[model samples]
Target: MDTPQNTALMRALTELPGPLPARGVIHIAIRHTDRFTVVSNDLAQHPTLSTVAVGLAVRIQSLPQGTEIGIKALAARFPEGEKLIAAALRELEAHGYLQRARTRLPNGRIVTRTVFCNQPAALLRTRVAAARPQQPPAPPQAPALPDVQQEQAPEAPAPQDHAPFVALVPPPTAPRQPSPPLPQPRELTAELDRAATALLSDLRRHASQLVLSESDVRQLAPAVAAWLERDTHPDTIRHTLTNDLPQPLRHPAKLLKHRLTVLLPPPLPGADDLAAPARPRIAVTPFQTCDGCERAFRAPTPGHCRDCRNAHGPAQAAAA
Candidate 1:
C-alpha cells in the first residue's frame, strides 16, 4: 500500500488549500525519525518526489498558524501507520530532498522560527510562481495596431430614402483558425491535478502564515485550477490534481463533493451564476460618468475611460 510519507503527503495534498507559509509551526510527524526531510529534486528524476514536493507545499499553508508537533504524529495521521512515511522520507533525503524547520531553543524552552533548512534557492522562483495568483492570458485578440481606432468613421449618408436607409453592416472578419477542442471531464481532471501540485510548492514558499479562511481558500482555488485546466503539458493535469485536491477535501467525500465538486475548471464556474455578473445597462451612482457624454461608466482597466479621462492628461472641463 502507500507509505507513511506518501500517506502524509497525500493528506497534505488533498486536504490543504494553497501553499505552506514560512510562519507557523510545520510538523513533519514522521514515525521513523524527525531528523529526516521529505523532498523531491528534478536531478534525481523521481516522479513521486515531484508529486510529494507539490503536495507538501500546498498543505503547509493551510495548516493552522502556530500548530506544532513532530515527525511521529504526522506519520500516524494517515493509514498504514508509519511504513511509507519512513521509506519515502529516507529516499527523499538520500536524493538531497529537504524541508523547512522552526526550531525551539537549544533547551526546548521556546519555539523559535529558526531559518529554513535545505530550501534550495535555485528552485524558489518557480515554486513561488506556481502558487501565486496567475492572471489568465487574455484571449488572443486582433494584434494592437498603435493607431487603430475603435470607432470607424460613419459611412457618408447614402442618398436614398428620405429618412435615410441605414446600410446593413457585415461583421468584421478576423483570421479564421479553429480552436482546440475543450478537454473532456477526465482530461480536465488530470490537468488540474498537476497544476494543483505545482501551486502547492509555491504556496509553501510564499505564505507568511498558516490557516487560510474558507473565503480565502475559495479565492485561491480558481487561480490554482485555472493553472491546471488550461495548461497544455502532458503531465500537468495529474500533478496538479495530485497536489491540490485530497488534502483540502480531507473532509468526508460526501461533504467534499457537496462543498467542492471539482478541483479544476477554475476559469469556469461551478455554480450556475458566476463572474462579475452582467454589467448593468444603467450605471449606478457609485460609478463615475463621462464629463463629455454623461454616459455613466466603469473603465475596463483601472485608470479611466478614453472620452472621460485621458491617460496622459486631465479630464477636459465639461458638463457633469
Candidate 2:
C-alpha cells in the first residue's frame, strides 16, 4: 500500500493539469462591515416579481427614511426610465412590499407618506395587530390590610334617594366627515383612452407647472376620456386643463381632475337617434292613368309621370 509507484499516481491525480475551467456561477462573497442591507429571501427570490422590481425594492429598503423614491427621482438615478420604474414601484405595492398614503398636514398641505416593508410578512403582521381589538388594563389593586385591621374596618354606606347623583360623561370628540366620492368616467374605447392619455401626458408642453407623474396620467386618463366621449376636442381639454394657471400650483393633477369633472359638457343632441338604426324609408307613390296614352304611371299626386310630363307640351300641361 505504501509503494512508491502508488504514491506517485495518487499525487498526479490530486494535482491540476492547468487552471480549472470556469463552470456555472461561482460566488466570492465579501462580508460587509458597513453600508450593507439585509434583504429577506422571500423578497430577493420572489416568484412573481421581475428582476427590476426586486432590485428596486432592495434599493428602497436601503435608503434612509424620507428619501425621495418618486418615479422621476428614481428614473434620474437609474437607467430604467420612468415607465419601468413606475411599473416596478406598482409591482412592489401590489405585492405588499410598499405602501403610499396621501395625508393632509395641519398646515392644509397634502403630502404622500411612503412606507417600505423589508419583509411582506411583517407588513401583514402590522395590519393584523392594528385591526385587533385591545383589552383594557386591569384596575390597580388595593393593598391588603392586616387580618385584624381588615375585620375592624367600617362598612361603606349605600347612596340614598335624597342624595344628588352626577353622571361621568366622556368628553366629546370631533366627528369625521366622509370625503365625497371621486368622479367616475364613462366607458371608453381603446382609441379614446389613448387619445386621453396622450392629452394628459402632453399637458406639460403647454404649461410646465402641469407636469404629472405616470400614475397621475393613469388616474386622470379616464376622466379625460369621459370628456372625449362627449365629443370634447383635445385642444379644448388641453386649454381647460392648462388655462388660468395658479401661481406656484402645488398639485396639478388635482386641479386638472376638478376642472375635467366640473366642466364636462353634455352629449350632443340627437346623439342617441344617430346611434340607433335608422328606419328604412318606403316611397308610397300613387298610380295614375295618363289621359294622353291611357298608360298607368307612378306619381306623388294624381299627375303624369316624368316621361308623360316631358312629352306633353308646356301649354298642354299647364291647361291640364
Candidate 3:
C-alpha cells in the first residue's frame, strides 16, 4: 500500500525535469526528512496543485528563510519550463505556500518580491489595507422629568364679544391644459432590430420544425443581443442555435435562451485574462554547496551533508 507521503515523494522525484544533454553536469539538491519542516500530505491532494506544483512544494520547503525565489528560476529547474513553472507558482501562491507583491518605496523605487513559506501566512498585497469606517458616537440620554399638573392649578373666566362678519369666495381659475406626453426610450437600436430579425429568420429557415410565435421571437431577441454585447459574432450565434438542434423540437425559443444565457463565456479582460500584472521569474534556490562533501544543496546547511555531519560527530552531539 502506497501512503500519501510516499506517493507525493515518488511523484516529485519522477516529475522533475531532466538536465540538458550537453550541459556537462547536472546538479541535484537533496533534503533530509529530519532536517527541515514536515509538509502535510493534504497538499498533495489539493485540487489546484499539479504534478509540477507538487515538485515545487517539495523544493520550496527545503529552501532557507528569506531565500529569493521566482517562477523563471523554478521553471529552469523543473520540467516543461517557463509556462509550467509560472502556473505552478500561481498554484502555490493560491494555496498559501507562496506570496508575491509589488512594493513602492519612499524613494519612488518599485520592486517585486516573492515570499516562500513553510506555514500559511497573510496574503501579500501591493495596495495597503483598507481603513475601517469610523463609528458614530452614542447619543446622550435625556434627564428624567418629575410629574406635575398645570390643569389642576387654575382656569381664567371667559369674556364674550359680539361682531358681524360676511364670508367671501374667490373666482374659479380657467381650465388647465393637458401636458404633452414624453417620448419613450428606444429599447433596441435599428441595426440591432434588423440583426435580431435576421437571426430569427435563419432559425426559422434551418429549424423548420420549431414553431416560433411573435412573442417567442420578442423574448429571444434580447438574449441574442446579450450574446452580441459579450462580443459573440452574429453568424456564430446563428449557427450555434441552428446546428445540432434536436429533431421535432417542442420548444425552440426556450432551448436557445438556455444556451445563450448558460453557455456564454465571460468577457475577456483587455489583452490577457489575468487581473494582475504577470509575475516575473525569479530563482528558487540560494545555490549553496556543502564544504565537507562538495555537494550542492537547495539552501545553506551546517557546512556539510547528512553523511558528512555524521562523520564529523556533530549529529551525535546534536542528538544528545
Candidate 4:
C-alpha cells in the first residue's frame, strides 16, 4: 500500500515562528538552532516585514528540499492564508532571503524559479550557483537482455549553446514623480501689517506687562503670521502671550518676541501630505488619457479631449 501523507509533518512545518521570541509566554519548547543564520538589525527590524513575513521566512527555512512549495498550496496550510503568505514571500525576497529568477534550461526552455537561502548569500556566490548546471544521475546497468530484439535506450536531447544567466526579479518601479512645487503664498502687505499691529495692541490691554509700541507690532506681525502658519490659532497666541506674566512691568515686548521666535511650532502639512498614501500604492487604470489635453478621460480609442472632439468631431468622422 502507498504510504499515507504525514499530517503531523505538515502541521509542524506550517507552524514555525520567526527569529524573534514570542511575548508573555513561558515556552515548553523553542525553535532553537545552533546553525541559524544571523540577520542584520536593519533586516530584522525592517518596517516592511511584519509578523506574517517572519513566519513565512521561518517556514521556508524549516521545510525540506523538493517540498511542494507555492503560494496557493502554502496558503491552505497556514492560518493567515495565501494573500498574507504571498505578501510575506515578496517581503522575504526583497530582504535577501529569497530571489526569483527566470532561467533558460539546456533544453532551450525558460522557467521561472525562486532561489532560497537560509543566510544572506553574496551576489557572486548566488550567480555562480544559479549558473552551475545540474547533471542527471547515471542510470544503473540493466540485466543482460536476450540478444533477440533488445531495444537501445533513447538518446537524450543535445544541450543548447551556453548563455549567461540573467536575474529576472522585477526592476525597481519608477520613483513617484514628486508633487508639483507649491506656489508661494501671497506676500504680506501694509494692510495685513496694520492688522497684525492691532492684534498685538489689543494684547497689551489684557496684560499691563505686554508693552508693545506701533513699531514693535510691524516687526512682530511677520512673526505672528509664522505662528499662524504653524497652526496656532490667533486667540491661542493672544492667551499664551497675555495669560502668563511676571508681576513687574518690564520689557515685555522683548519677552513676547522671544516666545514667538523661540517657541514657534512646526509648520502644518500641505495638500500633498493629505493626498499621499501611507504605503506604496500602485494602481492600474483602464481609462485612457485625452490625446489633445493629455489628461485622463473616458474613451474607447483614438482618445481626444471633449473640447477637441466637440470642435473637430471624431477622427473617424473627420476621415470619412
Residue 136 error, candidate 2, Å: 18
Write model 2 residue lDDT over 1-320, tens digit each, in one string.
Answer: 57998787666655746564577643335589999999889998899999999999988888888898988888888888999999999999999788876654554345777878676675455556555799899999998766874557686998675422221222234376564443555677898879988998888999999989999998988888888887778998888788766667898888887677666677877857669787999979878887667788886667666776787768696899
C-alpha lDDT of candidate 4 relative to the true structure: 0.66
Best by TM-score: 2
lDDT of 3 by residue, 1-320 (tens): 66998887776666669743565644445766677667767665666678788878888787776665676666665565777777888888888787786654444344667766544522222111222455799899897564475335354877775332221212134366563331121356676766776687567666676557888777777667656656678778877677666545677876676566546555546766556877899868666678887887666444677667678797678789
Better by lDDT, candidate 3 or 2: 2
lDDT for each residue of candidate 1 in 1-320, tens digit (9 for 90 to 100):
76987987868755655576678765544375644444435433445555453443333333455543234654555442465555544544444444333332433233433112233433444455545889989888896565565666676988784432222222234366553332233343554645544554444233322234455444444445544455434355334333323223333323222222343334544465655577669854466566666676765434345754563354234422
- Would you list the clashing residue pairs of candidate 2? none
TM-score versus the correct structure, for each prediction: 0.19, 0.36, 0.28, 0.28
> Could you list the CA RMSD of all candidates, in the order they appear?
38.0, 30.6, 37.2, 26.7
What ranges in model 1 sit over 4 Å off?
Answer: 1-61, 90-97, 100-320
Angstrom error of the Cα, residue 260, model 2: value is 21
TM-score of 4: 0.28
Question: After best superposition, candidate 4 residue 33: deviation in angstroms?
Answer: 55
- Steric collisions counted per model: 43, 0, 2, 0
How well does candidate 1 match the true structure in TM-score terms? 0.19
For model 4, state the Cα shift of residue 293 in Å. Answer: 52
Count backbone clashes in candidate 1.
43
